[model samples]
Target: MTTDAYDHAAVCELLGAWAVHALPPSEQHAIPRHLADCADCAAEAERLRETVRLLDGPDAPTAAAEPGTAARNEPNPMVMSEPTPATRNAALARILAVRPPAPRTAPHAEPYAAAVAALRALLAELDPQPDGGPDLAAWRTPVIHDWTVQDTVAHLIAADEHLAAHLGLPANHPQDPQGAAAPGDTDWRTAWDTRTHRVIAHERTRPPTATVATWRAQASALLACPAANDPELAARAATLVGVRLPVAEHFLIRAFETWIHADDIGRALGRPVPPPPAAHLWRLVRLAVRILGLALGPTAEPVALTVTDAARSTEWILGAEGEPVRAELVLDPVDFCLLMGGRLAPEAVPRAALGDEAAVRTVLGRAARLAWL
Candidate 1:
């Protein structure tokens, strides 16, 4: 069938049946071609196929049962004969097993390295498949803040160049036009926005592939710098992006922005992006909390704040420590990150607040306004 004749969404909905070879012959033929160009659907198809493989494994019980239970003729307690809550969990575990482990990094740069790796994985989904489906040229689709997928990547290339330049790395796009003001003369925020606009304009003059190549090359160069792997090397403080922070924290900042934009692209493409893994997520949360604290200063009303994930919980007292907390707020770590990224509004983010609502609202409002992303 012609590409336009096949509904992309309808093909996507058939992924499960296609994985199990249950689709009609014509659909079976069309789906693989569709999967080739569609990263989101391709990934889902792989997952469904993996699930089928696991479900088709040996019919013997998953574990040995106690002696007396073996001959009961009842459903085998050790074998998953049908889907149950536990069987569903086992299926999910099998699906996750297919993913590669996160890359290793030094303690200080771990968050950046992991976040970079995570974003790369997401970007890979956008890669054009050898067998072909939709034209990869469609990457020009609008992503966020008036940036197309290619433009978003071009923005990151410009963004990371700041740190890469500070580290003395060779520029990936040396011809990129300068903003209105000389580098340091402009505040980082103004410089940042201007750089993004200039870079996007410059990149539009080239093929989207060239933009992706430049971004990937620059990111790889940044990660390869000695500072990324050595805490001592990263300890030298420098001011970039309007904040004075060590090179290590700057690396974390690079990670934070990369993941956020990746999320923007994921959303535009209809894929739900999972938050960063727990360890790296907490690093982002802690850093954002510190920055938020700095923005709030010491005199604001104190609010006892707690952020939690599936594995653990962290607590902090926002505002003056000497004063009793006037309110309490609790949030999921991912929700807090989204709030800090400005993707979630202060009032709309899922959270629990008590005591003085105004004080809690202040903390939430300040967090949402941080706009570091």
Candidate 2:
């Protein structure tokens, strides 16, 4: 109802649309006044606004040349015209000039940097203001689990904290107040979940913008760390999140999870987020395949896993080696990554398979199980 006595649940349902300015004028005007007196609504609104800011990128004209350059009556090709390659390049250059792209890093760390930048661009679309700032009221939109959009971001701060500390960056928020984990508590999942719950709860008390700032700041610091820039530095292995791997591989894991969660957030907002760049997508595919192989272990029955894209097809033998391949499975690069990310059900994901269904199902099942996101 577009009135002061609005049903809270109904109003909450509209927050996503409201944040994007999709509601009618009467509803738009009423929601803000309603927010003013409702503390819960106000906090949720603020969080949505902050999430919107992350979606924004520098502005550039979509079409047409400088003002007055086009003749008034003559058919102006620039009007409603697709930009030429040169024009597109120029626009991209301008965007970079206004807001520089992610920092350069070693090959292993490149995807993480790019994914971070991509998420920032995606989040900007929530509620872009005329002044080029974001002010959406959509943060309360449900994403994964019971987490709202704001909570998803706060979870990221918690998720990335382990890697951040591994890289020698200081933790932005203090440890969960529940208690110092028992000395013998070696379960990374329990620890990870605890910290995420704590961080999300803590972040809920503050403006959504503050939580975003903390997440972005920590990410920037991680990118700036020497390990991110130096292949040798990142080569040193350290166990984090229950896996022992080189820091470089861990960086790729970060990129993988960030992209996955960003996609989740986009889905919650009714936006279709594109997959990561081709090269980056492939890197994720390879890493996921390797991890899936490990999870399947060396003694299990082998499956011929082939990941293909427009440019090339790469194959791997998963499970035990000496025996003839029992099955051949083919997947699109993105589909494979999504499967590993746990975004797609193994049975539901598109694929081409030949040979034993049991072996195929095994690979798919293992891949889905690997999804911790």
Candidate 3:
């Protein structure tokens, strides 16, 4: 048995033996002394014992059992726990390094990339109408300050190309706007906005011949970006505000933009524009709710979401208008997407779905109050 120099984890393990009457006095006596002095060790002991009890109880386990047996009061051969500080500090260090994901009850994230890929393929297959092509007439909107589908396609492709320049694109990329003569070209905003609209006009005049094929390739490629797999990935210091994001995230956000634009044109064109599959829809809504929370702040309580079709539920906790976001509601995948896209109404959302009602509305902000379809 060790003395005062024992590590916390070993001490915790020893205490388990003592509770069950297996730890010898050499290790056992120090445990009581340590627990008396160390709050962290005591809490850990309590949690571990609770874990073992839950795991070993008769109603819980189907397998041959262990841990419930009485302890042999011998000086345990198992190393004595050195009740010390390293135990907690080590765990904290690992947490800080990995920034591990919080526990999630869902089986898997909705597959956004796959959904985008399918949309891309569908866009590719549409045969143009006899009037030279699928006319842009269906996309024109009378609304104030919103983008159309044509403008969307152009923007997604062009904006990424432009920002990719500072993030490591080749000098010959198509994002270079200023044809060497635009005023205040040095201001990145002026250059990007001017060139973005210019490209939008140019692409509108000569839309991509294999629109779907181009999008499919674009969407599929985004899955391989560095940011998607690594949480610690940070954008280059030189990037602009909206531009400081990973490529996979960028692709998904673009998918949101694309889908919204699709709805816009579809409403005008009078045709059904189905959203992505069940899984991807969940991720889309999940991302939107999270970003909205981050952009704003945490609400008082949790908000619940229910996807009408898949029956998947999500929960989010947002603070105030400008505070960090928390997942306080469980929502349905499809409904969540519709809610965020300037479409579905708040009244349509299942209030009971969110465990906390008052906090939900506050976090959703004006987006929840709109009366659109």
79-156: candidate 2 lDDT, tens digit per residue = 222333343323322232222236677788888987776565445444344454445467778899999888998988
Task: Give the per-residue Cα lDDT of candidate 3 at 49.
Answer: 42
What's the C-alpha lDDT at position 216 in model 3? Answer: 39
Spell out the clash pairs found in candidate 2: 48-139, 54-124, 55-123, 55-124, 56-124
Query: Between the candidate structures 2 and 3, which one is better when assessed by lDDT?
Result: 2
Over 275-302, each residue of candidate 3 has an lDDT whose tens digit, in order, gives 5654556667766766665555444433
lDDT score, candidate 3, position 210: 38
Better of 2 and 3 by TM-score: 2
lDDT ranking of the models: 2, 1, 3
Displacement of residue 299 (Cα, Å) in model 3 is 7.0
> Over 4 Å off in model 1, which ranges?
1-104, 129-134, 174-186
lDDT of each residue in 1-373, candidate 1, tens digit only:
4656656655543443344333344555666666767787777776665575466565623333333544555432222223333433344334323332233456777666655554554554454344543236558778877888888888888888888888888766544445332235446687777777888899989877678778867776777678877889899897787677888888888888888887888678664456666777888899889988888999999998899867889999999879988999999988998999999999899999889999998999998877855
Count clashes in each candidate, considering only residues at least 3 apart in sequence or on different chains: 0, 5, 39
Q: Per-residue lDDT for 195 in model 3?
A: 63
Q: What is the lDDT of residue 228 in candidate 1?
A: 78
